[model samples]
Target chain A: MPYIKVQITRENVTSEQKLQIIQGATDLMVNILNKDPEATFVVIEEVDTDNWGVAGEQVTTLRKRQAEAKKLAEANKPK
Target chain B: MPYIKVQITRENVTSEQKLQIIQGATDLMVNILNKDPEATFVVIEEVDTDNWGVAGEQVTTLRKRQAEAKKLAEANKPK
Candidate 1:
């Protein structure tokens, strides 16, 4: 049995999108490892930004910082 | 940075239980790998019985079969 788990930052995902993720993961396991689809499990988890931090910063703050840095870089670029 | 995802068959888990899982995973990663608690991510997913299967049987069906088998074995056992 093969178990595949995907972790995503909290966001509203459409049911169709979830289906795609499930099918895609299952296909990869079956094709690459020759695992039986019936025995393969795919679980997707949507994590809160605060609970899913990186580099000691919450994702919400990290994205804000990234955006600000990008704006500054664009302003400093020569024409 | 360490990411831990827990997949459980769908059940009504209390908020406290979820917190335990999150904290436990984060603690393990930090203690074992020296990962920063702020940089570690833990997500728990409750999978539907239909979506989680084994040996070509869905979890719902598998559980039912297991219960039946246990009952039969108990009945057949000599006193």
Candidate 2:
């Protein structure tokens, strides 16, 4: 059986999006790996920003910093 | 970098248990694979029974059937 796990930040992802991800992953295995759809499993995991980290920093903090940088850049854009 | 993911049915797992899993998984990589703990990532995913399947049936339905069978067997036990 082919099992796939997809992890993403918990950002209000809809059930419809999850369904699409499951279908897409299953399709990829079936098409490329010639895996049986009936035996394939796809699981989606949503982790909170506070729990996820990048570059030794929590994603929650990283997002806030990134947003502030983007705002500063926009304010400095040429007229 | 080594990334480990553990998936289990969501059954009121506590934060402490999750922390243990993360630590245990990281230790495994460190001891056996000789991976750096700083570069190792462990993610624990808790899935709903309805979302997980086994033997072509949802885990929710399978658990119900299994519980009923266990109850029936207990009822038939000798006095």
Candidate 3:
């Protein structure tokens, strides 16, 4: 049996997407690892931005900074 | 920040149980890994038993077999 789990920093995911993930995970195991779907498990979870971070900064704050930097670079670009 | 995901072959898990898992994971990170709770993410997923297995047999079937074998051994014990 293979257990696969994916964690994304988003909320309100639709059931259809969850099903897609589950099927894709099962298919990967069967195709690559020769595992059977009846014994495969896929779990997708959504984590809040505040609870997800990198380099000692919350994801929410890091995302905002990234967006600002991108906008600034675009404004200074020659067109 | 650290993300911890748990996948268990069970369904209809109570909210309290999930909370305990989340808290336990966060505590582990903070205490052992030196990760901050504010940046820790814990997601507990409940998977169906039909999708879990061990030793090339479905977990459900394996458990049933184990239970039956245990009963048989008990019945054959010296009396």
Candidate 4:
């Protein structure tokens, strides 16, 4: 209920991927908090990176964070 | 700094008008709270109407609210 909807503009993701992310986000919210997806309302907008920024900073940081997190998760994977 | 960005899907507004709305929203924040527009990052995504909803309600309510407010203001116009 108190989540912020984020719109990302990038060339790497397709519309199907965006929809998957939205559904995945809703699942994360529900699984983590036992909330309904309908009440949780998820919206994802795909945009051009040049068109969006964060605190006067480019949203490249978001992608960077995701990449780093993935690397960390892979590194900690058990055999 | 704590504002939620809203993406609107409508047919009546141009991109320039959307930009104006973004600037106006930032102005409202600054004027009402004395905040810096730069610090108050604004992002506006133009969405398709079918892609947006509000609490299981269509976003047509938003446009209706605006129209009603405008009509009320016009009716109360001072001579």
Q: Top model by DockQ, which number?
A: 1
Provide the TM-score for each candidate, comma-separated. 0.51, 0.55, 0.48, 0.40
Would you list the clashing residue pairs of candidate 4? A9-A47
Q: How much lDDT does candidate 3 score?
A: 0.75
Model 1 C-alpha lDDT per residue in residues B4-78, reported as the tens digit of each score: 878788868889999999999999998889999999999887876655544334566678888999999999999
Error of 1 at B3 (Å): 2.8
Instruction: Quote the positional error of residue A68 for candidate 4 in Å.
Output: 24
Q: What is the lDDT of residue A28 in candidate 2?
A: 98
**Model 2, range A8-37, lDDT digits (tens) per residue?**
989899999999999999999999999999
What are the clashing pairs of model 1? Answer: none
RMSD of each: 11.0, 8.7, 12.1, 11.7
What is the Å distance of residue A13 in model 2 from its true position? Answer: 1.7
lDDT per residue (tens digit) for residues A1-79 in model 3: 8877667787566655666666777788989999877777665557899999889999999889989999999999999
Score candidate 3 by DockQ. Answer: 0.08
Which of the numbered candidates is closest to the native, going by highest TM-score? 2
Range of the 10 consecutive residues with the lowest summed lDDT in candidate 3 chain B: B49-58
Give the better candidate number (1 or 3) by DockQ.
1
lDDT of 4 by residue, B1-79 (tens): 7464756665678878877878898998899999877788777666654334444333455568889999999999998
Query: In terms of lDDT, which candidate is stronger, 1 or 3?
Result: 1
Q: Evaluate model 2: give its TM-score.
A: 0.55
Residue B33 miss distance in model 2 (angstroms)? 10
Superpose all Cα atoms of candidate 2 onto the true structure and report the RMSD in Å to 1 decimal. 8.7
